[model samples]
Target chain A: MQVHIPLKKVVDNSYDITIDTLPKMNFDTKVAVVTNQTVSKLHLDYLLSKISAKELHVITLQDGEEYKNQVSIDAILESLFENRFNRKSMLIAFGGGVIGDMTGYAASIFQRGIDFIQIPTTLLSQVDASVGGKTGMNNKYGKNLVGAFHQPKAVYIDPYFLTTLPQREFSAGVAEIVKMAVTFNKEFFTFLESADLNNPKVLQEVIKQAVQTKASVVAEDEKEKGIRAALNYGHTFGHVIENETQYKKFLHGEAVAIGMVMANEMAVKMNLMSEKEALRVKSLLEKYNLPVSYVIEDVRKFYETFFLDKKSSDSAITFVLPLGIGDFVITDKIDNGTIMCVLNKFGKN
Target chain B: MQVHIPLKKVVDNSYDITIDTLPKMNFDTKVAVVTNQTVSKLHLDYLLSKISAKELHVITLQDGEEYKNQVSIDAILESLFENRFNRKSMLIAFGGGVIGDMTGYAASIFQRGIDFIQIPTTLLSQVDASVGGKTGMNNKYGKNLVGAFHQPKAVYIDPYFLTTLPQREFSAGVAEIVKMAVTFNKEFFTFLESADLNNPKVLQEVIKQAVQTKASVVAEDEKEKGIRAALNYGHTFGHVIENETQYKKFLHGEAVAIGMVMANEMAVKMNLMSEKEALRVKSLLEKYNLPVSYVIEDVRKFYETFFLDKKSSDSAITFVLPLGIGDFVITDKIDNGTIMCVLNKFGKN
Candidate 1:
């Protein structure tokens, strides 16, 4: 009556996030370095110098969160197809989260999948996006509405590239660092509050810490089934904000910064965290000049957008709220009145 | 120097293929039954009557391999977003390989993958597509060029639906069955030579054998890195045929049928298979009235198209040829002359 399609094989998909200087690597197969014009303009030659492949090509895409869509994915895919890049071929995602996400996504779906490496240039990506296997592109529906969990072959997190990063983009990266600390490690949160990231050593340590927190979480729950949802401490509200603002008004990390503040307000109202602890987190975000507030024109419209987020189920919205600091609770039990109250506090644009 | 993204976790993606009368299934989550117009007209009511869900939706796509493209994928994704389907939701691929593939693909990308069930109505899907986790759609380049190996949660192979399957479609399924027999099982090949498939019991047994053979191979390789390539015995040439004709000339299995003949020619030329063995295989194909020969207007063009296949590396095309009735050898060593000679045998379209 039944035949079993047994997939009982164990796969060691474990890879390391090596925080070192960029190494000159030689590859035996065709390789494409998928980057954006912005990153390529500053670092393309430097990146190109270090990588040698049997056949090497560069694919430059438009930069920014808005460009993270199906069109960009098609561009990366089209290049691979045109070159007759097969499963043995590889892609090197060589930019910020936008380029990394789209490139990783294109790698995931191309010929069912091929090896890809991450040479994350932005501070945000070097810490968060580069390590996790979450590859996706944003669609009109929302951020990461379409993606796959295809791990990269390796990730190189070199701090040297961050030297050319814009201050605003650098601050955007700090927001993600702050996120990791608040949800997973109180010591790291305290360290981040006082740490001067302008110092290269401090920045490297911070990148290592944030990546470690994300790595452990991803290792435990790769699919965000349980403990991994904790990583979305600020993402629930952040995704809706990104949608309402059309993904142009704020960087992804900036949106999450505001989402964390919003979640803190809800946490305070629900007695999950003291107002004092909430202020501490908010002040830390302000330290980096990460956007901590976004006024919603219509509170109801902002609240309704949460339903479109992949994190929400049909019946209720799943919110990840901090349990003071260094821990969190993933709950869908928050009442509508409580959420509306929190959203209203952001005021109007 | 390093932070580990330790994904040393084992995932058991095993599922059973049930071959019986269609069974009533109930789900607690929102469900979408993705099928085509033809299947809907013949079997929608019965399928709907047997399926109950908290929120049920039917997405009927155009029936054909040509419709298996990004446009169709977008349609499926749009429906999920419009209906507010989430990770907790499930999809039931309730038609043939086309429906199963697009549905599985849609599910794989929806919120970075979700659970999908396969209820394959066509024999080609029941014994092949429904069991393997391989999910994708065709593009202008080739068949299944873009896809993910996202396994289904389960498969229901209800033979009752096959009674209404057109004679040609039935033979298309036979092509795949004959494929499994020739590549892996000498006894199975002998069974097909004399087996009365019109007998329901005989057909069910054959389906079970094919499923079993496929199940073991998938269990060993999972991602087609080794023995699984043997399953593509006819697919390399078949994909080019489908691409050349724009997926309109033959059913997928039918193309594979002709592809098998082409591979047999190469095998006989290389002394891997006896001419007598090749003739016996061709005769079995004729018994089912499966298409065995295809004329290429330009053999050079057809030969060049093999490079476009996913199985080919940049340098050489991999071919799976039968060493005899039940054994296979995967090689990329055949020179240009031998392949052209075989294509010359097929002649112009």
Candidate 2:
């Protein structure tokens, strides 16, 4: 018999984000603000001034992709338990993608699951991680290998925090925005090509467009059961790059920037994308000062990394290739020779 | 914008359980059969003979409630990782409720979440745990205080395993069956009054009724958002009892047996159920030799334990009381004076 597991709309606990204003959500339950030392020192006061929680605690972990492991996640869970946070408690993910991912995961599993709100302070997180319900901590085996598809109660995206963001971090966020446009929104891609991303008004419009595009796609396929996989246009290659570097060498968005370029090259080789469109994508990425090149040492070694990705099946690597700018195809049927040629181009170039 | 996460229906997976025969679905992926030493000694051979997985590994845990902790759960996960089990690999929960709950939890968090199937060998699990998506490991705080609502890929029940179950364990399963009937099915309750529970034919009918009843309730309220909390008819009191005793003195189902009696007494005090109906419920439990009595040390201490229960919020302790023979009510409105009277009565006894 077909059964429907009712989707719970978590009301009474919600928040909204205006572009330049800090989010203000008053929570009566025990609230823990999870952030990295970098974000905490930079904008913790700005966030605290806006929050109206009854009793708020700040938990700061070491910053960076290397700190996204289970040890860091365990530390976060232990702190919450030590504070006697109950199921009614809430966690505020107050950093970049790494902090948001780990906090969302810790919330998802702590006391089974608890209420959590995302106060994404990173541009990358603001554009990508905030909308997806994917929450998990990284392990030695892989990134987000130990996690749950737990959605946040709400997301508070205040671009006001971005004023203090490092320039490199700013570029990283745009890399993700560029990815959203490549596979799903060609018109948005063109807008990004000419817009001054540093301008607050243009950034606000970009954030809204990216969120709406992601929200519509997520509503259609939340679990990546079908159409949602296309949203992973740059992620398949990005994950391989992240894994090869042990998630240490580049910012997550920066790695994805390189991944998107590599994907475009593969699409052109497969005749799925015209060379002109592929070059147009690289130029757009470069316009935002995002990396459009990477040095791949061994093509086979790079190809082997794809299988380790959670999205890959046992023997086949799923690729999300752009047919051009707005349209795309998901397939594992690409021949080995074509893949090798694409990898050769990125190999130590 | 409100984004709804579309729940994935695992179509490639799923199986039906029958009373007389074992399931026939075969697996080419690696399989870990998680069972207790007791169940393994008795039924492992039979289960192993039926599975045609590429490689089948047996990881036996010590058989007891005390063994259901993070240490045991981690052992299972470590073994899976050691065996190089990938995302496609599956874990089969092959014992009673404790084994099933821990196994399901390990699978849920391992590599984010992997697939798990339930082959409930105990009656209590077949009727209750196997149907719900709840998976957890207990700690000093409380029973099931840490867990997730991760449903199994499939559940398989073969009553033949029950043939070797001891009378104590067998009666424990009956306690859950009785709980199910009393809370939801009046006709089923009437059937139980005179039904020969030990008879194989009668037991099969009872198991099917309990499973189907619980399944319907879970389908409607997967996350225990509303109607599903009613399923915890005797659990609120039962959990406190189990906690106070350190989960050592009584089997989960056994504590629940005494808890049901306590709930009935409260119901009679509130005039929700007649004394005669309560007596019938007691007599049914007595026929199976399930323990329906406990000594209370202090009335206030016992009452305080209710508040610590995960279900209880700051407002009041939620009690699931019987409305009549087969109907029940889940509420926190039962006054302190009434609860005190019940606890005081326990001390007197």
Candidate 3:
């Protein structure tokens, strides 16, 4: 006989992204602000002043993507256990994408799961990572090979934190904004073509638009089972570039900047996009000082790396190619000959 | 400006529990049967004959509760990674509770999450652990101190597996069945009071009744935020006993059996259960050859261990005390003097 265990419960995982100054937040239960030494040195005092809890603790780790691993996650969990933090305790991600991803991952597994809020400091994370529920760490195998779709309770995106961001990092953030515009918003792309991000007002407007586009896509598909895969337009190739480079040569968004150009080349070859459209995207990345070119060392080896990607299935590589400036398509139908033709364009001479 | 991310989606995580001989089961994706040495020695070939998948792999760990830690979980994950098991892969928990919990926890975190089915071999896991979504490993802190509420895709409880189960282990399983009946169903409790589980028909009926009662409670509260904590009638005290003995002295269900008797004494002391009612419950446990008494070496030390329990928050300890047979009251209001008075009975002279 079959006994049905009905688990029908309305899960309200919805949260708001506030694009303004940091608000004074209070928690009745214990809270931990998980940050890197770099971010904490710059804004820990200010963050502590604005956030209060019955018992608040700060856990500081070394800065850089190199630190985003199981060891870092264990430190966070160890701190929670040492403090006797219960299930009701909350965590605050107080750094960039690496910190946000690790903090969210640690919260997702600590005592099953706990609530977390994202206070993204870097420009790249504020516009992209903070809004998405994807939380994970890089392993020996690949980046984000281990993770969970754990949404934060709220996201406080204060652009003021960008004042201390370096010029190169600021440009990296702009790459993601360009990606969002290229995939879904033509008007935003048009605005970005001429808009100067050095202007705080224009940057704020751009960040808001990017977040809105991502929010809509995520709202439609939270788990990346459908339209959500569209958001990873540049990530498929970008992941491989980062993997090949040992994640040391380029920043995440900068690598994605180059990845988008390669995808656009494939799109142009397939008649899905015009050469002019591809150049326009390349020009946008150039405007932000983002890398727009990479010479392929070995075409076959590069293609093989795609299988290691979480998006790839058993054999076929799923590529997100641009249909036009504001449209895209997800397909595994792109033949190797066409892909090689595109890769040969960037092959080392 | 506030950007709203509406993540409103209906999640249907319902699954069926089949209570009969293990049927022919098949999967199209890669499958791994996670079991222990003992269970594999007894029934691996039998299980392999009945189950088929596109790619079937067996992951065997050393048997016993002591091995249920991060190491075992990592071993399972390492095997998956080595075999290149993707998110679409499935896992079969083919042992008892430890295998089920660890398999479920591994599935919950591998590539964010994957699907797993429970094929419980022991009575304790079949009637109790198989149904609930709770999955995790014991840490240095406590038992099940770390876990997730990941429901199985399905549960296959084959009574035929019990034929090979040791007598002591069989009694341990009955302890869980007794715990279920004592706290939820009076009619079922009456049936179990005199039922000979050695009789196949009577045992099947009892298992079905126990599963049905659990299903109703789980339906109302998938997470233990409210009424679901009632199911932990014996676990709160049992966890401490297992912890105090370092999980070496008693089996999980055996500790729970003694825990139920302790709870009954507390209920009688509070005037919630009559002495006769408490004795009736004890008699039922004894009838199954389950241990119903445990001597506390240090009353205060045992009392202090409750704070480490996941169910307790800060200063208050939530006890699921019987209001009478087949009824309970979850209370934190019981004063320390009364608690000590009850502990004094179990205290070594």
TM-score of chain A of each: 0.98, 0.93, 0.98
Which pairs in model 2 have colliding backbones?
A112-B147, A145-B111, A145-B112, A146-B112, A147-B112
Instruction: Kindly list the per-residue Cα lDDT of model 3 for residues B137-202, writing each as its tens digit.
Output: 998888877777889999999999999999888889888888888888888889888898889999
Candidate 1 lDDT, B60-90, residue by residue in tens: 9999988999999999999999999999899
Rank candidates, DockQ, best first. 1, 3, 2
Candidate 1 vs. true structure, TM-score: 0.99
lDDT of 1 at B89: 94
Each prediction's RMSD to truth:
1.1, 3.8, 1.4
Candidate 3 residue pairs in clash (backbone atoms < 3 Å): none
- Please say which candidate is ahead in DockQ: 2 or 3: 3
Per-model TM against the reference: 0.99, 0.89, 0.98
Candidate with maximal DockQ: 1
lDDT of 3 by residue, A255-297 (tens): 9999999999999989999999999999989988899999889
Query: Which prediction has the highest lDDT against the true structure?
Result: 1
Local accuracy of candidate 2 as per-residue lDDT tens digits, B16-82: 4444567665898989999999999999988988898988899999999898987898789778766
Tell me the lDDT of model 3 at A290.
93
lDDT of 2 by residue, A60-113 (tens): 999998988868987897787667677788999999888998998888888789
